[model samples]
Target chain A: MHESASTQTNPSPRVQRAPQQPKTADAYVVTPAIDVYEGAEELRVFVDLPGVAADGLDLDLDKEVLTLTANRAARGRDRAVTYKRRFALPREVAAENVSAKLEDGVLLLTLPKRAALRPRSIKVTSG
Target chain B: MWSLLHNDTMKLFDAFERQFQDSLAVRRADTAISFLDNGDELVISADVPGMKQSEIEIMIEGEFVTLRAERKPGAFEGFKLSRAERGAQKLVRQIELPCRIDAEAVRAELKDGVLTVHLPKAEGAKPRRIPVKASA
Candidate 1:
């Protein structure tokens, strides 16, 4: 061994990779294709997200905030793209029973209306 | 004097072209999307306000869904476009999914200018429980 291999690498002369830049455009945000419907006791929402998978999707509910995040693998020769959307809950939602499904290229998020938010039927007694 | 007239005409044409391009861009920005979820099913709604059912096409491949609609130029024939702020615009939206869904159960309907798509969860994807039994 003429000299230690570790000494041959010079810190000053070594080339460093550039830091990745953060997205700063509105187009980069995952603008979901959405649909809203009113049912007997709750409101249903459907969000369309293409190229995102179940493992790559994240749904979080904090207080009255509902957040949806999704990541897709790189395709063809194109770079990877990330999509995120946040919706302000109209009222308190049942966080425990919230369910989601992804099929084809659509993301379905089912939010059951809180018991208090649902309309109640009153029984009137004949007087 | 003739050169002056030619320059004025060129300027007018340029202004018309710029206005046309701006309107086209505005139409593209008018696309709106919404997501609704009930415990049983997920509904996706989009605002293709001026689109006809026949003109809209929805396709799903793998985990990607594409929505394409075109408003024919003369769809509103003979109707004066007075103060019309909506319609006359083509809409296209592509969305990605977050989980595997039951493609076979997917259904779509359009009414009152809103497109609603129902996506049900697959049997294997839904939450289930395994019950424990007593051993002898």
Candidate 2:
């Protein structure tokens, strides 16, 4: 069943990510590209971070912000590189239930909406 | 000796030539690659995230190594894109090595999102250490 018309009141939802800023100036840091998708039940995020191992990845979440950091190991003369980015959490997101997975150097984050924010159906009765 | 000086000059010219070719390759492919000339092997690494092993193609001919890969767009069912910075891309890079390598001994591995290739130096191209002997 396709019920997308009534699912989102706003056809286009604006993402509220904060402006990108390097945490430190002394290190070699880069910003990885990311893609965000929105569904009726949850929000999905995909981040490209090639060469970053699972052990070098870190995700931090609080009431307002979500921070992602990853470090790639040095190869020969190339020095170690760091990727850092931050995002502001949406109001309807269920922070406690958020899940993250990393595969083939891509990170996928699933943020489910709060129960109250989900759509509800009303039954009609004859007068 | 004059021969030794001529060899040094030729080596310098070769280095410059390789650098120019590498720069052109980078411009054409828009991809950054790292080439490390180890004592016995050359290690080449490139960032190719969101690509499957089967999607990458490697070709080696003469002294050049070529890499080709493509990244497909991430489209999900029943979902709409709110933001998209990582999109579909196709990359083709042809890099020349500083020395001859044994084509049969080449090894490649993909880990995390990085593709690494190890090219072993050819037997005739490797530097050999010689011992000096004194006789009475």
Candidate 3:
């Protein structure tokens, strides 16, 4: 998923977020391209959702499943469509620790690893 | 002294050449787009995933219009990637507006990952309203 990240021009913007998820409606759905990276502390999932406004975006985490939806209103000369993607997280994620930001056309999600999941460096003690 | 200046010029030239290559990579890559003519205006829709509004460049010269944006790559040094698809690449696309347009009156917006541009026909080129009169 991340292979193309190197090949694509990234204009990722500084994010200002809408913490409140909006009321979602049924609309045309298109699957946005996504890149997922696993870090020591968190998982970074980047999704391309061009045309979706902050108010139209929604994120829901149910147990190990993550579903994101964002609607794009038809601007002055185009037709409206909805973007949706679902991921069943392989590892557990701390729901409270998750943070999301919509920048440029990409949705960047940081899902912090659960307490037990984070890799810890053990200190070497001379016995 | 002359060698120092020459080195500086060479460095600048190399930088410019890299920038040029980057733009060409984007231009040659296939990013999906649609162009529609609505009689009075030309509507363009492009999907520029992972790009910000400020990163986009829309240039119009005569009948040609160009779209450019980049999808920057994040640090992947030690992280393991689970799936492989899509790309983090510079995107460039171009299209002709059919007829000359009122460049100053053009409007564009980026929403979701889509860029839309509306270019209206030049004033003189717009079809004039004609009224039919009855002869008594």
Among these predictions, the greatest DockQ belongs to 2
A-chain TM-score per prediction? 0.68, 0.75, 0.71
For residues A25-70, could you state the per-residue lDDT of candidate 1 as single tens digits?
A: 3224444445544343443555555556678677878775566766
Q: lDDT per residue, candidate 2, A1-127, as tens digits?
A: 2346654765643332233423334446666677778776887988887878888888989774677888876678877777777666666678889889998888998988787866557699999
Per-candidate clash tally: 31, 1, 30
Tell me candidate 3's fraction of native contacts, as a decimal between 0 and 1. Answer: 0.49
Positional deviation of A6 in candidate 1, in angstroms?
A: 40
lDDT of 1 at A95: 62
Each prediction's DockQ? Answer: 0.01, 0.23, 0.19
TM-score of chain B of 1: 0.61
CA deviation > 4 Å runs, candidate 3:
A1-26, B1-32, B36-40, B104-107
- When 2 and 3 are scored with DockQ, the better candidate is 2
Give me the displacement of residue B40 in model 3, in angstroms. 4.5
Can you tell me which runs of candidate 1 are displaced by over 4 Å? A1-29, B1-136
For model 3 the TM-score comes to: 0.69
For each candidate, the alpha-carbon lDDT, in order, equals 0.56, 0.74, 0.67
- DockQ rank, highest first? 2, 3, 1
User: Which run of 10 residues does model 1 chain B get worst, by summed lDDT?
Assistant: B75-84
Q: In DockQ, how does model 3 score against the reference complex?
A: 0.19
What TM-score describes the B chain of model 2?
Answer: 0.71
CAPRI quality level assigned to candidate 1 from its DockQ score = incorrect
Task: Classify candidate 2 by CAPRI docking class.
Answer: incorrect
In model 3 chain B, the worst 10-residue window by lDDT is: B21-30
